[model samples]
Target: DFFWFNPSRLPSPAEWVNVRRIRVKDAVDPLWWMSKSAYPKANNRRVLEKYSDSMIQLIQNGYKAKLRPSGWDISTKFQKDNGGAIPPNLLQIANTESNSWYLRECARSGVRPHPARYPSRIPKFFIEFLTDPGDVVLDPFAGSNVTGEAAEATQRHWIAVELRVDYLIGSKFRFIRPHPVLAVPAG
Candidate 1:
């Protein structure tokens, strides 16, 4: 049943076989004041310096979640001003109030960047595609354990690993049943 072979290892329809992504709600932190409270508007630089690590981690991890940049209209612009080739995928569209900026601010201010969340759909898709009814799935970097929730919904066993203890505990709310948690070895 294999129709295509992608030697480049790019994720393609044929290579995936049954694997796919799922849909879920955006997990951005609901509380907004924390950003300002921790890093006052006046002392933006100070805040940025303090929580720089969190910001870097967020930027690095954002790509894995496939959070396409929001707020640009390339099609509209191409009609009026033609300068550079329009990127086919449009990884990031220009938006004034960008998520990247917000995340960077949050990371710099030591405020958790409203937890850039993944939708349940993402994990659901993967579970349905890659696994059968009883097969197992693993989310090694399970932030809020949304993957576990999706797996549960689709009747697939899941193993979600998170370094932070609080997230591991909070993930229980999202899942109907709890899957066994395994400790990841420290590098």
Candidate 2:
């Protein structure tokens, strides 16, 4: 995949007539879908069918079709609050360590290294939704660089930024090439 923030490009779903948007943001969270909504998993179904059919076609036609969404808009405001939601007490945790550590370790060893992959489909959907082939997609806090991988998989250019050196160095997957990072501009 091409990893670039400013120079490269991503893809737009307009390329495929099959992909369409039927509704706007859900009422509960303008940015997310309400689980109780009738079409809560609308995009998911379409994505699955598209990928499944494409996989089958690739096996028979000797060519693979890359499917991406029409737009790429990631918002962090709508996430559910985890402050008081977590269980009051668990088997682990000392007064010195933050609660996040337990969850982090659980995530690391449970299934995938990054238990929270943020769903590859989400980035793939965004890359497809907001851009066109070769268009550049920039992700400033690209945790795990999933966006970069999704962009590359969709043939779009991707650029990612992450301040945590350990996440970058210890990542199990390499979706974006590492460049010498410079300091952020001072205000």
Candidate 3:
């Protein structure tokens, strides 16, 4: 993530904040055993660039992957209805370093903001990539239940647990309708 955002700071970047996002998923379904690395992205550009500097540099220089793997050998071996999506390991999210968005959302919904919370995109990305409709997503260490919001938005069942009831209650803002004062007028 760091390398992708700041390619100029290569070799050894001082960035370490994004390293905290570690997700583990279990594909208990027997059919998904063979495609182990299919959804769970193992590494980011930081690690990949370190492992293969020249290879990643080629893309950094200008090269881009084929929009779809069609006509490629891999496409022949494996294919899915969502094959058009080229899953990228490197994530580029802006304004996630702060909970400003969450705070604003809380105000709009007339609720308090949790002191600490992750962006909904974090869980939304993983949930969309790893699970299908109606799957259950569990956030064992749910801070403000952002994962639960993402799961609910994606039409999945979710269970979120937090040490404090206040924080869990604050997460309800994610589901509450925005106040009329904050709603934008139709153009």
lDDT of each: 0.47, 0.46, 0.55
Q: Could you tell me the lDDT of residue 42 within candidate 3?
A: 30
The model with the greater TM-score, 1 or 2, is: 2
Q: What digit string (tens of lDDT, one per residue) describes model 3 on residues 30-108? A: 1111124456533222122232454444534544445465664432223222213343555444324444555677676
Model 2, residue 144: distance off in Å is 0.6
Q: What is the C-alpha RMSD of each candidate to the true structure, in Å?
A: 21.5, 22.2, 12.0
Better of 2 and 3 by lDDT: 3
Model 1 alpha-carbon drift over 4 Å, by segment: 1-114, 176-187
* Model 3: colliding residue pairs: none
- TM-scores for all candidates: the values are 0.35, 0.35, 0.48
The C-alpha local distance difference test score for the whole of candidate 1 amounts to 0.47
Lowest-lDDT window of 10 residues in candidate 3?
25-34
lDDT of 3: 0.55
Better of 1 and 3 by TM-score: 3
